[model samples]
Target chain A: MGGAAPAAGAPLVGANSSGGSLKALDGRVRILATAAFALATVSFSHFGPLLIALGGAMLVARLVELPILKTLRRIIAMDMFIAFMILMLPFTTLGEPLFFVFGFPASRQGLVEAALIGLKANAIVLMAMALLSSFEPVELARAMGRLGVPERLVHLVLFNIRYIDLLYRELHRLRTAMRARAFRANASWHACVSMGYLIGMMLIRALERSERILQAMKCRGFTGRLYLDGEERIQRLDLVFAAAFAAFVGALTLWEILSVAAL
Target chain B: MHIVDGALTLPVIAVGSAITVAGIGLGLRQMPPEKIPAAGVLSATFFCASLVHMSIGPSSVHLIVNGLCGIVLGWAAFPALFVALLLQAIFFGFGGLTVIGVNTANIAVPAVIVYYLCRRGVVRSSPQVAAIWGAVGGALAIALTTGCVALALSFSGDEFIPAAKLVFFAHIPVMAIEAVLTAAAVYLIRRVKPELLDAFSAASPDLQPVLAAAPEASLRSTQS
Candidate 1:
C-alpha cells in the first residue's frame, strides 16, 4: 500500500513540491471558491463570457502551478467523450447553414452551442481541479463537517479516504495473483467469470476486514463519535484568498451582465 | 458515465441536487451508528472496485457496480456512492463539482431501486437462485441509470436528446458486464459470509458479542 502509485486519472496535489501558498489555504475556502466558480461558469451561455471564464480558469491553474500539459491532456480526453454530442449538434440543430457535410447542412447555431458547452465544461473542470484537488480527502471532509454537512456523511467520507488506498493495494495483489496464474483478460465468458470471481473474493475480503476494524474500534471504546484534528480557524491567508476570489468572480459577473445588456 | 458541468441546465441541476439531498437523508436515517464502520469500509471497497478496468474487444471500461452495492448496502448505497462521486470529482476531476449532485442521483437512485426490488430474493433464495436475481438487479440498475441520464439530458434541451439516446445505447454492453460480475459476487457472499446479508433483514446484534468480548477481563488475559 505504501508503494502504490496514484492512479492515472487521479492527480496528486503539488506533485513537484511539498509546500505552496495555494495548498496552504483552508479547505473550506477552497471548496466555496470552487463551488462559486463552477456555478458562475455554468451560468454563461454565450461565447464571449464562456471563453473569458475558461481564460480565468487557466489563470488560476497557472497561479496554482498546475502541470499545463497534463491538464490540457485531461481536458482533451473529456472533450472526446462529448465529441459525439458536439459533432451531432451541427447536423440535428436547425439554423442558418454554415456548410454541407455530404448531403447534410451544418447549422451555425449548433456550432455555437457546442463551443459554449465545451468552454463551460473545460472552465468548470479546470477551476475545480485548481481549487479543491489540492487538499487531502480527510482535510476536505473535516471542512465539509465544519460547513454544516451531516455528521454521518462526513464520517462516511473519512472512512472511504482511510481505506481506499488499502483496498487499492489489495486489488493490485489480487491482479498479480491472476497474472501468475497465466490468466489474461479477453472477450470471452471464461474471462468474465474469472474477473467476476476475483471481484467476489475482493468483496468477501473487504467485509471480513471491516468486521475486524469494527472490533478494533469497539475495543478502543469508540462510541459513535470521532474527534477530528484541531479546530481550523480562518487564518489570514484564508481571508486574503476569499477576497481575491470574490473579486475575480465579481469581474466575471460584471462581464456577463454587460454582455447580456449589450445583446 | 458522468455528465460534466455546463451540459446540464439550471433546472435539471437544481432538481437533481434536491433529490440527492433527500436520498442521502433517507439513507443516513436507515443506517445506525453501529453500521458506520461497515458502511464506510464497504463504500471504500466500492470506490476501489470502480478503479478496476475491464477489457472489451479493444477498449476497456471501468466497473460501476452500483447494483452489487445496493444489494449489500441497501439504502446506505446512496450516501456511499455519493461520497465516491464527490471524491472522484475532487481528486480526479472526472466530473465537475456542480454536476456531482446530478451524477449521484443518476447513479445512486437506481441502486436504491434495485435494493428494494431484489434484496428479498437476494437474502432468502438459494445461492444459485440468488445469483440470478443479482444478475437481474445489476442489469436493471444500469438500465435505469442510463434512462435517468437520458431524461436529465433531454429535459435540459431538445438538442441533447440525440446525445442522451446515444448514452443509453452505449451502455448496453456495460449492463451485461455488470450483470455477470454482480451475479458472481453475490454468489460468493452468500456462500462465504451469508451473515452480511442478514444484517439488514434481522435486528441481530452481531456487534454486541464483539463488544462484550472487548472488556478488561479478556483484554488482560490476552496480554498475559
Candidate 2:
C-alpha cells in the first residue's frame, strides 16, 4: 500500500506520486497566472462582457497545453452541481416567465441568470484547475509564504496535502475489509450504526500512525521549520512575468470600475 | 459539507480560513505524539466511511463518522479532520483549498460537541446508546454543516442560495444513513474490539457508566 499509485477514481491534483517538477512555470508566469485568476474572479460578479472575455481566456488557456479529456474529467463533478443550480433557477427566481414546465413557470430572466452563474463558476473552476495542475504543492506553499501567509498555515497545508492520499488508501483497505465481512449497511440500521463505530476506531488508529511518523521526523532532525534546496530561488524571469500579469489585471479592473461608475 | 471553490463569499472564506488555522493550532497543541497514529486512522476511517454510499433519492450520500471521532479523540479530532478534509479536497475535490477552513470547522465542531455530549450522558449509556448517539451526532453534524455551507455559498452570488438549498435537501437522506452507520459501528467495536474503547475511556473517566450500562441498555433499546 505504501508505494501504490492513487486509485483510478481519485481526484487528480494531489495524486502525483513523484512530486512533479517544482516551478513548472517561472516566477513571472506564476505571478501572472495568479493575478489573472484573481482579476477574473473579481470581475466575474460585475460585468457580463468581462466574464465572457475571461471565460474565453480560460477556454483557450486550458486548450493549449492540457489534454481535453483530462480537463473534462476534472469538470465532471462540477457539472453536476452546475446543472442542479440551473434547474433550480427557473423555479426559484422572481422574474418574467418564458415557459411552463408541467405546472411550474420557467422564468426567462432566471434562466439567463443561471446560465451566467454557471459560466462564472466554470471559469473559476478552470482557472483553479490550471493553477493546481501547473504548480507543485510545495511551490504553491512557498508562493503563499512569499505573499506573507502565516508560516503555520503554510505548514499545515503542506502536511495535509502530503498525507491525504495515504489516508485514502488506508480507507480503501478498510472498506474492503468491511465488505469481506459481509457487513452490509442495507441489512439494518443497527449494522449502519456499527459502521460509525468502525469509523471511530479507524480515527484512533490514524492518530497512532501519524504520531509515529512525526516522531520519526523529529528523530531525523526535523525542527519546526521546513528547509528546501537552493533551487527554490525566485528567478528574474518570474518577476517579469508577474509584473506583466498584474498590469493586465489592473487594467481590466480599472475598465470595469469606470464602466460601473458611468452607469 | 464541502463548499466548492467560487461558491462562497471571499470574506466568509477568509474569516473561515483564519478560524480554521486557530483550530489547527489548538488541535496541534492539545494532540500528544502517541495520539497522532490514532488521528491518522480516524482520518482513514472518515475517508472510507464516506465511500460507502447508501442510495436514497436521486443521489447517494456517504456517512460522516465525526461523532465517533469526537467520542474518542476529543479536541484532537480537529487536526485529524483537517487531514481528512485536505485529502478529500485533493483526491475527490469535495471541497476546495480556499474553503478548507469553513469545511473543517463545520465537521470538527460537531465532533467536539458529540464528545462533550457523550461524556454528559446526553446520549444513552449502553453500546446501543452509544450507537444511537453516534448516529444522531453524525447526522446532525452533516445537516448543520451543510446548512452553514449553504449560507456561506449564498453570500457569494445570487444563484448560490438556490444551489445551496438543492444540496442541503439532497443531503437529508444521507444524514440519516450516516446516523445508522455510526451506531452500528459503535456496537460492533463494543462486541469484538473492546480495546478501541480504551481511547474514549482515557479521555473521560465517566464513560464507565456507559460501558456498565451497555448490556441492559442494548437489550431494552433493541427490543423497543
Query: Interface RMSD, all models, one decimal each?
Result: 4.1, 7.2
The native-contact fractions of the candidates, in order shown, are 0.66, 0.32
C-alpha positional error of residue B77 in candidate 1 after TM-score superposition, expressed in Å: 0.7
C-alpha lDDT values of all predictions: 0.79, 0.58
The candidate scoring highest on DockQ is 1
**Residue B9, candidate 1: C-alpha displacement in angstroms:** 1.0
What is the TM-score of each predicted model, taking all chains together? Answer: 0.90, 0.75
How far residue A160's Cα lies from its native spot in candidate 1, in Å, is 1.2
Candidate 2 lDDT by residue in tens digits, B125-187: 666676666667667767777777776777666656767887788777767776676666666
Task: State the number of backbone clashes in model 2.
Answer: 41
Query: Compared with the true structure, what per-residue lDDT tens digits does model 1 show for residues A185-205?
Result: 664567666777877787778
Stretches of candidate 1 exceeding 4 Å from the true structure: A1-19, A228-230, B200-224
Note the DockQ of each predicted structure.
0.46, 0.21
Candidate 2: residue B189 lDDT (0-100): 62
Scored by lDDT, model 2 comes in at 0.58
